[model samples]
Target: MITYQLSKPVEHGGHTYQNLSFRAPETGDLIAAEQFKGQISQTVAMLAMMSDVPLPAFKRVPLRELYQIMELTKDFLGNALATTGD
Candidate 1:
């Protein structure tokens, strides 16, 4: 698991989030993310799945933070992919 503190808290769906914790993505998460039409939408869905957060909640994140989250997700997934090739 990976945990990241938010630069600022975000309120969504009656909950306030101070941080995001993500588990490694599963096969279902990957398939679900692919359903999105664009790379941005796919990445957002993937992040939501990995973090176990609802899609709408990500919209509340600051853009700068969101980019960081995207990089985090990408790096973790990339590392996973690299290992699986062995």
Candidate 2:
């Protein structure tokens, strides 16, 4: 597992939430997420799946916020990959 402090938080239904904790995704995770195929919603969905937080909470996140969240996920995963050599 790897944790990162989110520079930005995601809000949904008047609730604010963030996950600084995530699991290193497996190759299967990549294959599972591939159906999203460059779509932001699916990318966010993948990040939510990787996070320690409950995935349903992110379902309501605004589309505008997904890019930033995706960037954070990318950075976290990249750093995780570098450190773990997985």
Q: Which candidate ranks first by lDDT, i.e. highest?
A: 1
lDDT of 1 by residue, 38-79 (tens): 666777787888988888987778888888887777766764
lDDT of 1: 0.77
Q: Which residue window of length 10 is worst by lDDT in model 2?
A: 77-86
Question: TM per model?
Answer: 0.82, 0.49
lDDT of 2: 0.57
- Residue pair clashes in candidate 1: none
Residue 32 accuracy (lDDT) in model 2? 58
Expressed as tens digits, the lDDT of each residue in 27-73 for candidate 2 is 66555555554555446556777874545676655555555556656
Per-candidate RMSD, Å: 4.7, 6.7
